[model samples]
Target: MRADRLVSLVLLLRRRGRLSAATLARELEVSTRTVLRDIEALSAAGVPVYAERGRHGGFALLPGFHTELTGLNHDEALALLIAGSRRGAQAFGLGSALASAMLKVVDALPESHRDIAAGAAERLLIDPEIDLLSRRVADEEVPGTIVAEVRRAVFAGHKLRIHYTAAGRPPQWRTVDPIGLVTVRDRGYLLATRSGADRTYRLSRILAAEELDEPAERPDRIDLDRAWQERSTRFRAGGDQVTVLVRLNPARQEELLDTALAVRAEEAGSDGRLRLSVTFQDSRHAEWALWQLGTDAEALTPQWLRTSLRDRAAAIAARYEPP
Candidate 1:
């Protein structure tokens, strides 16, 4: 706990540049005595942390104390910037601050490294396709005001009042205790505690958000990273666990196994036919898979699926009939 407190104190000084013992104690949920002891530990560890005692004083890091990013190679630094850009560089609450910080870092780099960094930037380009019709399916810019509120709630253990719309539903306002933000694919999600439970909501669905004055104590036993991982795994697993048996030719079998879907291949008899077992999230998705296989694969089990596949084929044939 002391180690954590010390690290947090150092980061706080780095981010805010100054903080009072009372503020640090409240943020870290410790007493002023404990905070002073942790500060002492940090100073003992050569953290360059110092405290001031007066009417207009607290604790501050010595001027010129800064972390150096000299270890990163040129390619690595450019990769970081490009990655940031993909996450809505202009829309993130810290985007301008990050850009300013990056400029300072670039200026501090050696001349040779600067040239390499420039070259890498010129060579890296990200072209994301924009879809304008569907707000639900598009990546919209996160409002700066909302971004700030979310960050404050996450860091300070405060609750947030958010106006949001669930999929296929009208907008409604609710209070959520902020936890963390996760980016799935290119979209952003807020993992929060709602109605005494954890839930994930799309950032785009949030019309407005604000921090509450009331603070919720941080959970003592929660492992947020592990909780997120388990939730994501269950979400991927719960959708239609149906397995389809399909017969594929040797050439198509290889291609099917290389696809994004989970497909298991096995030899069937000695006639160059292969058996493939595929799991789909839903019957509709399974039907789409069967459509892609076309005439190359045939369903071997599950009478309902086989019948559905037959009906679909018949419908397609009827469509191609006379006119």
Candidate 2:
């Protein structure tokens, strides 16, 4: 917080050229004495900051003082601003504060570059759905206080006392050593290790969570990045692993080959139809794929799948016919 207040003071001086101690204090919500001490600290750190004592005089950054902002291209800057706006500006924790800090960076840019940045921001509109999905999962629906406390516990390596209610189960209290938080498909999950278990719980299922004062040693083996990668790989690998054989018309064969779901293809008979071998995650996904090909495609192997598809089709047909 002190570091944030220091940065804020620097940006304020950079923007307004001169601000009184009282004004800086009011803006930063600190006392005038605190503002003066912060200015002294900034000057001590070789920031070229100074103050004047008199009516209508105040603290100001010396002329020609500039800080370099790195790694941001035109598109990146626009994208960053657009993302901040979509995060509701205030709900992104430090992101909102960082967004405000970006304004000073924009102010420091040359007029031509500034106009380019502004134009890009206005022309490149990020869709709301994509923006919403990009936010921190904990911030999506949970109260700010809970999100903050959980984050604190995770960072401090503290244990959490939580009341969780799984689907089809009664709510019960459990003590978990908070490992980390993960966002999967826009859902927030607490990657905690419970007593005698190795898996984590989704935080949304938690009816109540409170941080404990006791700290625990951080686990060296709990790599979040690796866990995320493994989860994605396993999910993709686990989808119906059955080898499906389908006969398709020539035109339908071309369509099927163009799709990501098509795993393999081969000529079926002299009639010029094709036998496609595909690995699908589930019968439902395969059925959907077959439906997209309409009458041109027919399942050839896995009799159970074919029978199931037929029964489903018959049931669907029965719903529409005259009783």
The TM-score between candidate 1 and the true structure equals 0.58
Off by over 4 Å in 2: 1-116, 130-140, 220-222, 231-302
Q: Could you tell me which residue pairs clash in candidate 2?
A: 239-281, 240-281
Q: Which tens-of-lDDT digit does each residue in 43-160 have in candidate 1?
A: 8888888878898789999998876476554434433564556554433355565555577678877899899998998887654454465445355678878877886787778888
lDDT of 2: 0.72
Cα lDDT, model 2, residue 251: 78
lDDT of 2 by residue, 1-323 (tens): 99889999999988888999889999999999999899889989999998778898999999999764665554335436545454433332334445555776788778998999999888876434434558633444555566566767887799888888876799999877877776544456777767745446665677777899987445755888787666556654765566689888977766666543447556567778877787676777777777788778888888987887788789989999996
Instruction: Per model, state how many residue pairs clash.
Output: 0, 2
TM-score of 2: 0.50
Best candidate, lDDT-wise? 1
Query: For model 1, what is the error of residue 180's alpha carbon versus the real structure, in angstroms, after optimal superposition?
Result: 0.9
Question: Candidate 1: worst 10 consecutive residues by lDDT?
Answer: 71-80
